[model samples]
Target: MDIIKGVPLTSYILLCSILFAIGALGVLYRRNALVIFMCIELMLNAVNLLMVAFSRYFNDSNAQVFVFFIMAVAAAEVSVGLAILMMVYRNTKTTDIDALSKLKY
Candidate 1:
């Protein structure tokens, strides 16, 4: 396979995979809601990086378009999520999701 820049395709894929795994681990292990949110962003970024790599390799623009959509969604999600988090903190004085009880009225 032809090299993309100075790096090989296999290396790029492995790096993206590692980034995704780390993000997953962070999301799974973190207790703070903000940290979890950040981890989710990390995962999304990893996916975006992978998509760009594939787009470049295939000489296609579709993947880039998909990535743009992903970025838009992520931005909207962060905005709404932070707004909700602020609301939750204002009501409860905490952002620890484990302390949340959805059944409480």
Candidate 2:
């Protein structure tokens, strides 16, 4: 659209980079599994944004198709990941990654 045309590709790249960095930092510094999972989703969305930006700039459809696939995969990942997290929380009463060490036995 006209709005997208006004923005430069570099700006999009920079924004996505910043988002990815924040996501990475959250994933590394946060102890809660749910927060880490949300960060992972943030990272994935950054990549998706980049892909859509590039696809629009290049007037290509393949990148958009890939984005759809990525969304599908993300959806499946979220369902399975949340299910596992729920089970873990039910068993351990906590979502902290460090708390999972008790499973070492």
Q: What is the TM-score of each candidate against the true structure?
A: 0.90, 0.93
Global lDDT of each candidate: 0.93, 0.95
Over all chains combined, what TM-score does candidate 1 have?
Answer: 0.90
How many backbone overlaps does candidate 1 show?
0
Identify the leading candidate in terms of TM-score.
2
Q: Check candidate 2 and list the clashing pairs.
A: none
For residues 12-93, what per-residue lDDT tens digits would candidate 2 score against the true structure?
9999999999999999999999999999999999999999999989989999999999999999999999999999999999
Clashing pairs in 1: none
- Lowest summed lDDT across 10 adjacent residues in model 2 is found at 1-10
